[model samples]
Target: MLGPVTTSDPLLTDRTPLPDGLDARLRDHLTFLIEVDKLKTVLRASPLAAADRRENDAEHSWHLALMVMVLAEYADEPIDVGHTIKLVVVHDLVEIYAGDTPIYDTEAGVTQVEREEAAAERLFGLLPADAGVALRALWDEFEARETPEARFAKAMDRLQPLLLNWMAQGGTWRTPGVTADDVRARKAVIGEASKALWDAGRHLIDEGERRGWARQV
Candidate 1:
C-alpha cells in the first residue's frame, strides 16, 4: 500500500517564501473565494425554472453567465462576450452581503443603491488590491449599463427571472400587487439588449396572460 501523505512533508512545505507582498495578496484572493460562497444561501424572489423553491443569488448569477454565453449573438450591438460574462457573474456578489431585494420593492430599491454600494466595497475588498479594483470597476460598469457588455449583461439579468416566473406559472407575478403591466415596465430594458430575447419574453408574458397565470396589462 502507498504511504499516507503528511502535511509536514517537504513536498508540502517546499513552497518558497512567497515574495514580500504575495502572501497577503494570495490570502486575500482565497478569503474572497470563501466569503462569496454565502451567495448560495441568499435567496432571490425568483424560483428555479422547474423547481418550486426560490433560486439563490449564486444560482441566478451562474444562470445569467450561461445565458450570456449562449445568447451573445442575439445582442443588439456588438459586445465583449467575455466581459459580459464577467459582468453577469460578478454583478450580484453584493447581494451576498446586502441580501436579495425584490425588483418591485420601490422603497427598498431606493435604499438598495446605498446598501449595495457599501456591500460591494466590503465584499470586493476581500480580494487583493488590484483584483478588488478590477472587480469593483466591473460591478460599477454593470450598474451603469453604458457599455454594450453591460447592457447585454443586464438584459440577461432581467430575462432569466422572467423566464423562470413564466415557467413557474407566474411565480412572483402572482403576488397580489403585481400586474402584467408591471412586469412589462420592469422588463422593458431587455429589448435594448436583444430583440429576439425580448420577443420570446413577450410571448411568454402573453401566454401567461392567456392562461390567466399573469395579469393582463
Candidate 2:
C-alpha cells in the first residue's frame, strides 16, 4: 500500500554527495516539473489584464496565487493564506494535460471532468510517489471545495477571469451565445466564500450589462 503523502522529501533539495536512491527520486521529481511546464502552453479563454493576449494556465495559476495573498482578508471567515495559495497554484496543473475548457462553452458538455481526472492522474503521477500522492490529494481537495481553504481558493479562481473579461470589454462574453446570466451562473460560487467580493463582482456584472459590453439573455 502507498504510505501517507508527505510534502517534503530529500528529493526536493540539494544534498552533498546525495543519499542512496536519491538520484532516482530526484529524477522523478524533476520530470514532473519539466512536464508541468507545458501548462504555460495551454491557452485559457480569459485575456490578461493588459488585454494584449489570452492568458495561459500557468499565468492564470500564478495570478490566482497572488490574489490569495492579497485578498484573503475578504474571505467569509479567517483562512490560512498559505494553504489557499497552494491550492490555487496546483489546482490547474491538470490543464497541462487536459487542455482548458472555457466557461462559456456549454457545448463542451460533461466530459471535461473525466478528461481532467485522467490528466490529474498522469500529470501528478510524474512526481516522486509521495509527492504525486500529496499533489493529487491537494487537487482533489480543490475540486471538492468541501473545506474553507478550498472554497476561498475557488472564489479567487472564479473571480480572476471575471475581472479579465470585464477588462477586455466582455472578452469571451462577446462570444456568440454567452450572456450576462451565463457569467453569473458560472461565478455564483464567489458568494459562498466572500460576500464582499461577490458584491463587488455583481457590480461589475451590472456595469458590463449596462454598457452593453456583456449581453443579457
Candidate 3:
C-alpha cells in the first residue's frame, strides 16, 4: 500500500525567490481563488435534482460545464467544446459578487446588466493583469453570445436550470404567476444554440403544464 503523500507549504517555507513580478502574480492568483470560494455560498433559485435545498452558484457552473461536455454535439453551429466549457465556468463567477437574478423576476432583471458589469470588473480585477484581461474577455464573450462557443455556452446555462426544475417537479416553474408562456419566452435562447435542445425543453414545458406543474396562460 502507498503511504499518504505530503507536500510542503510554499508560502510558509523559505524558498528561492521567484522572479520579480511572479511573486505578486502568484499572490494575486491565490487571492482570486480564495475570493471565488464565496460563490459556493451564493444561493440560486433552482433546486437540486435530488436534494431539497436550492443549488448554489458554484454548483450551477459545474453543472453547466458537464452539460457542455455531454451535449456539445447538438450545437447549431460547430463549436470548440473546450472553449465552451471555459465560457460556462467563467460565466457565473460574477454571480459571486452581483448575486443571482432569477430569470422570472422582472424587477431584478431590470438591474441585472448593471450589477453584473460592475461585478465582472471587481471580481476579475483580482487576477494578475494578463490573466485578468483574458478571463474577463471570456466572460464578455459569453455575455455577447456572438461566437459559436458563446452561443452554445449560453444554451447550456439556460438549459441546466430548466432541466433541474423539471426534475424537481416544477422547481421554479411553481413560482407564483409564472406560466408556461413565460418560461417559453425566457428560455427561447436555448434555441439560438441548438434547435434540438429547445425542442426538448419545450416538450418539458408543455408536459409540465399538462401535469399542473406549470401554469398555462
Candidate 4:
C-alpha cells in the first residue's frame, strides 16, 4: 500500500539554510523546487515500458515532455512544442500534492477536480507571486484544453499511458470492468489533437482486445 502524500522533504526542512543575501523570489523558487522533488514519490497507475515496477508522477511528466518534443509534428494543428512541453510539465505538478487520480478509477474521479484545484493553489503558491501565477496559468490552460498547445499537450498526456499500457500488454486496460470500447471512448481525445496518433492507438487497443489482453465489449 502507498504511504501518505509527502509535499516536502523533512530533511530539507531542517537542513537547508536560507542564504542571507538571497532574494524572496529565488528563495521561494528554491523552496518550490524542493517541494516538487516529492513528486518522484507519487506513483501513477501505469507501469514503466521496460521495468517491472509502476512509474512515478515525475517520470510520467518527463516522458510526456519528451513525447511532446518528438510527436509535435503529428499534431493536427501546428503547436509551439516548447510551450506544449511547459503545459505537460505543469499539468501534473498538482499530483505532487493531490496524488495521482488514475484515469480509469471512477471512484477517485469523483473529487478529482476539487482535490487538484486545492493542490494547485498550495503547490504553485509556493513559488514567488509572479512565477506562481505564470505556472498556475499554464496549468489552467492545460486543463481548459482550448489552445492548440494545450490540446496537443493533453494529447501527449493521454497517449503516453496508452503506449505504456500496450507495451505492458494491457497495463490499465486489464483493469476490471474496463473494455477496449471504453479505452477507445476515453482516448478518442487523441484524435482531437492528432489523427495519426489516435489511429495508431486505436490499432493497439483493437489488437490488444483480439489478443485477450483487454476485454472486448
Q: Estimate each model's TM-score.
A: 0.87, 0.88, 0.89, 0.93
Q: Which ten residues in a row have the lowest lDDT in candidate 1?
A: 4-13
Model 2 is weakest, by summed lDDT over 10 consecutive residues, at 1-10
- CA deviation > 4 Å runs, candidate 4: 1-20
- For 1-217, candidate 1 gives per-residue lDDT tens digits of 1122222323111243234555776767766776677789889999888666899999999999999889999998999988899999999998876777899777667668777887887778768888999999999999999999999999999999998987788988887777888888899899988899899888888788889887764
For residues 40-124, write the lDDT of model 4, one tens digit per residue: 9999999999989999998999999999989988999999999999999889998877889888888888878887888888888
Clashes of each: 0, 0, 0, 0
Backbone clash tally for model 2? 0
- For candidate 1, the per-residue lDDT at 171 reads 89
User: What root-mean-square deviation over C-alphas does model 3 reach?
Assistant: 9.1
| Model 1: pairs clashing at backbone N, Cα or C within 3 Å | none
Query: Model 3, range 1-217, lDDT digits (tens) per residue?
Result: 1112122223211243334555777878877787788789989999999788999999999999999999998998999989999999999998876788888888887778887888888878878999999999999999999999999999898899999999988999999999999999989999999999999999999999899899987
Range of the 10 consecutive residues with the lowest summed lDDT in candidate 3: 1-10
Of 1 and 2, the candidate ahead on TM-score is 2
**Pairs with backbone N, CA or C atoms under 3 Å apart (clashes), candidate 2:** none
